[model samples]
Each structure stands twice: as C-alpha cells, then as structure tokens.
Target: MKAARSDRGSQTRKLLLFTAERLFAEYGVEGVSNRQVSEAAGQSNNFAVGYHVGSKEDLVVAIVRRHAESIERRSAEMVARLPAVPALRDWVSCLVRPAVEHLASLGVPSWYARFIAQAMTHPTYRKLVFDEAFASRSFRHCHEGMFRLVPQLPEEVRRERDDMGRLMLVHMCAERERALQEGTASPRSTWESTATGLVDALVGLWLAPVTGPR
Candidate 1:
C-alpha cells in the first residue's frame, strides 16, 4: 500500500511539472499562480503545487532539474569526445549540441525550451535559472574550453557577448520549438542543423572584431 501510494504521488508530481511547464511557457511565469498550476493539473487540492513542489520558485527549479540530468549527461559525453586540442567550433559544439540534442530527444510539443526561455528572462527567476544551468561541471568545462580559444576582450565586451550568446541560444531554441509545435516553418529542417547553425553563429559572435573603444 505504501509503495502504491508513493508511485501515485510521484506520478502526480510529474503531471504537475508538465502542466506547469506548458502553462508557464504560454503564460509568463509570473502570470501563472501555484493554485492555477495545481488546478490545471486536475488536482482537487489547489495547494498541490505547494505540497508537491513548494513555492513558485521551487516549481521552476523542479522543472529545470527534471531536464538537467539528461542535458548534463549529454554534455559530459560530448566533452569526453573532444580532441586533445579542441578548436573553436569543437568547443562550441560541446556547448550547443547537448541542449539541442536533449530538446530533440523530447520529440514534438516539448515545452522545456520555451519554459527555460521564460525562466531566463523572468526578473525574479533569472538568477536562479542561470545558477542552476551553469552549476553543472560539464557546462563549466565547455565554457572554459570555449573561451580559451576566443580572443581576449575587455571585460565589458566579454560580458556583453556572453549575454548575447545566451539570448541567441535560448530564444532560438524556444522559437524553433514553438514553430515545430505550431506546424510553422523553421529555418533549419532538423535540430541537428539548428545546433550547427548556432555553433557557427556563436563562433562568429565570440570571434568578431571588437571595433568599439578599448
């Protein structure tokens, strides 16, 4: 009986997480309340979000955590395959492919990319999401490896391009996901091609001449 109850509870939490991701993706994170998430998940108790996942912040983290493991695993595998002296595009592929591959593995109608785009842009949740994302060892490895190949720039320029690169990756994936779900046209025919395009663009973005003031 206890085992059965635990399984049901686990299933309920998964359902709430899925429902919340879709709602939060469509509606801004701040626009959706915990009660609404619970209600949307078909929970009789509106407090199911709290009981199963704690607060809104906790819910967002839970959503991120759900996908983090797969992304991290893919990242680690890619990192392991890097050559002795990985080039700019090689390291860039480490950074771009894992997330794209994970998104691809999710099949159609996946809300994770959009949900992440929303979380990254949210005022309250931005830092929390970034911290969770960058906390992975594989991410740090890819980041450091990529930057080593990139030319040195002023601190401000480096920071600016970092933000630009992040926005590009997150929003592009989100847009592609949205397009796929809506049956609209995407620039790339496959997620693999999308990752290649992002890797190419990011390499150019990081290596672009710093024509501005020193």
Candidate 2:
C-alpha cells in the first residue's frame, strides 16, 4: 500500500511539472499563473499550486530544470555514440549536436535556452532554477565528456572553446526569438549552423588557419 501511494504521488508531481512547463513555454513567464498551471495540469483544486509547488519562481525553476535534464540526457546519449578517441572536431559536435537535433525534432524553440540565460542572470531570480532543478552531477559529467573529447587542447583553450560554445548557444537562443517574431522557420535556423561545421570553424579559428568564420 505504501509503495502504491508513493508511485501515485510521483505520478502526480510529474503531471504537474509537465503541465507547468508547457504553460510557461507557450505563455511568457510573467504571464502564467499558478492556478492556471494547476488547471492546465487537470487538478481540480485551485490551491494545488500552493500546496504542491512552493512559489511561482519555484514553478519556473522546476520547468527550467526539467528542460536542462532532458538536454543533458540527450547530450550524453549522443556523446556515447562518438568514436572512442574523438578529435577536436568530434569533441565539438559531441558537445553540441545532441541539442540541435533533439530540440529540433521536438519542435522546441531555442527560446527556451534564452529563457535559461535570462533565468540564470536575472537579478531577482537568477540561480533559483539552475541550482535546484539541474543536478550538479550532470554538469560534472558534461565537463568530463568535454575533457575526454578535447584531449589535445590546453585547459585554457578548452575553457575558451567552452565559452565559444556558450556564445553560440546564446546566439542561437536570441536569434530564435527573432525568428519566431519574423515567422522565419527552417530546418536549420541559420545557414552553416551545424554542430560539426561549427566545431570545424572554431578549431580553425583557434589554430589560426583562418579557413572559416570567426
């Protein structure tokens, strides 16, 4: 009986969190309300949000965490498919390919990444979601994966590449918002945005061959 009750509770929490995520994504963070979340999740009680989710910020953070975990899991799975001794080119795609393919298939807007940046740097609510929703272990695993892939780059170089990856992610996210407003949808948001291609460009830029975009 206890096990059954626990499973039921877990299912309920999952339902609530999933509903909250969809609502927040469709409606901007400021526009969605907790009661609406509860209603959207199909719960009968208006007080369900207060009882189940602690705060509006908590709800937003929970949504962000969910997306983060999904992305990380996809990333790990994709990385696991790479060659045992990955080159810098392989390493770069391993870090980025999963995100582009997976999110694209799910019809997810890169706006979520923008949402994450805004959440992470928000004066009022920064770190609320990042610390709580994402497991520290996931970030650790990602760092390890990158280290394995970029075995040749000095630590400083790797860090610079990582920063570049972040810039690309942020750029993708910001551009997505514009694309949505402009209704310019495409399989590839921008030309030459492939993870593998991006890695090649970055590697060349870092090495000074000057073969591609900086």
lDDT of 2: 0.62
Weakest 10 consecutive residues of candidate 2 by summed lDDT: 205-214
lDDT of 2 by residue, 58-175 (tens): 7777666666677677767766777867665665565556555555554534345545555555555555754643344544555565566443665666677666766665556546
**Top candidate, metric lDDT:** 1
Clashes of each: 0, 0
Candidate 1 shows a clash count of 0
| Model 1 ranges with Cα > 4 A deviation | none
The lDDT values for all models are 0.92, 0.62
